[model samples]
Target: MHFDLADLRLFVHIAESPSLTQGARRAHLSAAAASARIKALESQLDSRLLYRDNRGVELTPSGQRLLQHARLILRQVERLKDDFSEQGGDQAGHIRIFANTTAVTEFLPEVLAGFLAARPAVTVDLQERLNRDIVRAILDGSADLGIVAGPVRAEGLEILHFSTDHLVLAVPPGHALERLGRPPTLADTLGYFHVGLHEGSTLQSFLREQVERLGGTLNLRIQVASFEAACRMIEAGVGIGVLPETAARRHQRSMGLSILQLDEPWVVRERSVLVREREALPGCARTLVELLRQVGDGVVAP
Candidate 1:
């Protein structure tokens, strides 16, 4: 029996999305079209693939097993396209990249802009996630590459050094932090409302771990997906936030956010890039990865 790649891709989208409606939108299909596709897929497999509920659809046992093979098959198809593209005809295929918040906001903007300029035919699907989640994505063939900060155990992946970044506390003007008359430690500021990065972000997770060690915890008033949003939260006096030094200072003047010094040694961290395997990466992915490593000054590489 032959399987349709369109159905498999749509199934993957539905599996990852919060709802069938949203998944259909992502796949650019009308709800009726998506339902028909899923029904055909189920009929072809002769098993139920998803369980629809009020909250959303969940994978049935058959779907759970099929998801694994679907991801692998789709990945192979993408590699084939990239292989052909690299043979010199017009380039094609997409690259899915997962990166941490700091790299997403601070580093990748310029890096990706340059890569896209040179290879206009290639598409990059980028997502922000914590290092741990990025690890899972790369291992499962769901993501082509990942850029994350802090230590990660990537057993089956090829790793390379990316960059280093420092985390600094951002507070609003006239906040109590200003009256402290000196640099405050992370623990010193844990008592107040704070803004934070996404729940799975490395910096945010690391900050939470640090606070727990100090017999305190973060009292986040809000959680934002980007550093700019966190800066906005601080600017409104909604809460204090920890941010990358470069990002904090970049908007310090314009956003009226203050950077508070942290004396903690672990506040500085290094980033690394993870891929399934260097040799196995497709042509477009290889090109983008090399550009990422070589763009800055030939320093970031294993």
Candidate 2:
């Protein structure tokens, strides 16, 4: 049977989108054209791929099965592109690295710098995402590698222990919580306004979940995108903030922000690097993973 990549790509897009119209737009096809293509594909396959109605299309069992393989095939196609881009044996390829705020902020820069210096022909595209989102991107074939700030399901991925990240609450020096010498439980501070990361951030999600577990609700005063922003908001006396230890120390001595140890075991976050399986990574991406794995490359001790 002849399989068309274009049809498969459109099918994947349609399956992901809320409506066939939206998916066709994303694929740069007119609704009529896209509909025609899908009809032809269904005829060729002798199966219904979608249940179409006014609202949207739902994937049939056959469409669902095809989506799984389509994603894998497209991922392999991207791999082929990266693997073939070369210049005189000096690896020339693009690697996409998706990481959570902690790994992106504290760990990856220096490591990536050294790797890029050695492999000058390789290009790195780094993006910051929440930890679980990073895992999803990797599993869905959208990202070549991922660095997440905690353990996640590793069903089909190769894992690398990257670093240890400890979180502490940052408060303005004279804040009410600062008067107490003992570490504060999350419940103790739920009454105060908080400087939180972005709403959908992994750290923010964890904090919110913990607050819920403690039978309290988060009262966020402001939401910023990074630890630096949160620290700055804290320094401005806006509200208390949770930050990585690396950031807290760097800012504490200068910003005069007081670091309060979190009285919870989960505050110490473990970071890990994940890939589609070590061998599946292209040469350029694999090299970077090796650099992360190298013991002496400042891999923080547990």
Candidate 3:
């Protein structure tokens, strides 16, 4: 029973993707070729790997174990390549980061721009994901680093303080909530129609969870894709919105929106950086982490 690195790589892509065809595309293989390879791999292991249905494929128990090992092995292989490249005076590599919406939209761009400018040989694959998914990706070796908001419960991961942000309500000037002259709890704003983030946004999902916990539902007047759009809608008096304080401040004057603090514990949020093992990270990845730490320290304003 033997499988090559290519087979392992393909399997990893397939397991991570939504469909076999998509996985094949990621691996730069035709669908038929990828299917044949998977079959051969299953035969070599003497176990079924994936359960196929109309929607897509789900990994079998055996496939799940293989995926775990495969990701670890691939990460090790990439590290090995990085080490050799560094020895040859070419410190070039790719780093994958999974971050939440706030980090993605409000924090990372400036930092990433400078980092990329300095390290011409390094490439970054940054993806927006939910905090929980970010933690899972780091633990599973699928992501080199993660920036997550709120509490983290991952036992073995290294957590670094990144930044602090708050969820604030964005209201039009002279809105009823604004006239109240006090920090309003989420419950207090439940009756007002709201401008909300897109349905797929992690922040939106988080807000929905909070609303459900409070035994209320959002009376959404409109749903937009970004903080800016939500601010625009709020400024137009379509509705109020819950947005990051960082974003609210940035657009407050221009958008003529009032930013109100929420009287809730969860409104104050801490963003943290996560890694499986910092010392074990690739050289380029480690450098990126340090740069992020500098930003957190206020040594460099991002």
Residues 39-107 of candidate 2 have per-residue lDDT tens digits of 999999999999999889999999987887887787677567766664522366778889877767666
Candidate 3 local Cα displacement, residue 264, angstroms: 1.5
TM-score of each: 0.79, 0.79, 0.92
Q: Residue 211 error for model 2, in Å?
A: 1.1
* Order of candidate numbers by TM-score, starting with the best: 3, 2, 1
User: Which residue pairs of candidate 1 clash?
Assistant: none
TM-score, prediction 3: 0.92
Give the best candidate by TM-score: 3
Which candidate gets the maximum lDDT versus the true structure? 3
Tell me the tens digit of each residue's lDDT in model 3 across 89-108.
22578889999888888879
Q: RMSD, model 2, all Cα superposed?
A: 3.9
Tens digits of per-residue lDDT for model 1, 224-289: 988888898899999998788879998886898878887788778777789988766777788777
Runs of candidate 3 exceeding 4 Å displacement = 1-3, 53-55, 86-90
Q: Least accurate stretch of 10 residues (summed lDDT) in model 2?
A: 293-302
Which ten residues in a row are the worst by lDDT in model 3? 83-92
- lDDT agreement with native, every candidate: 0.83, 0.81, 0.88
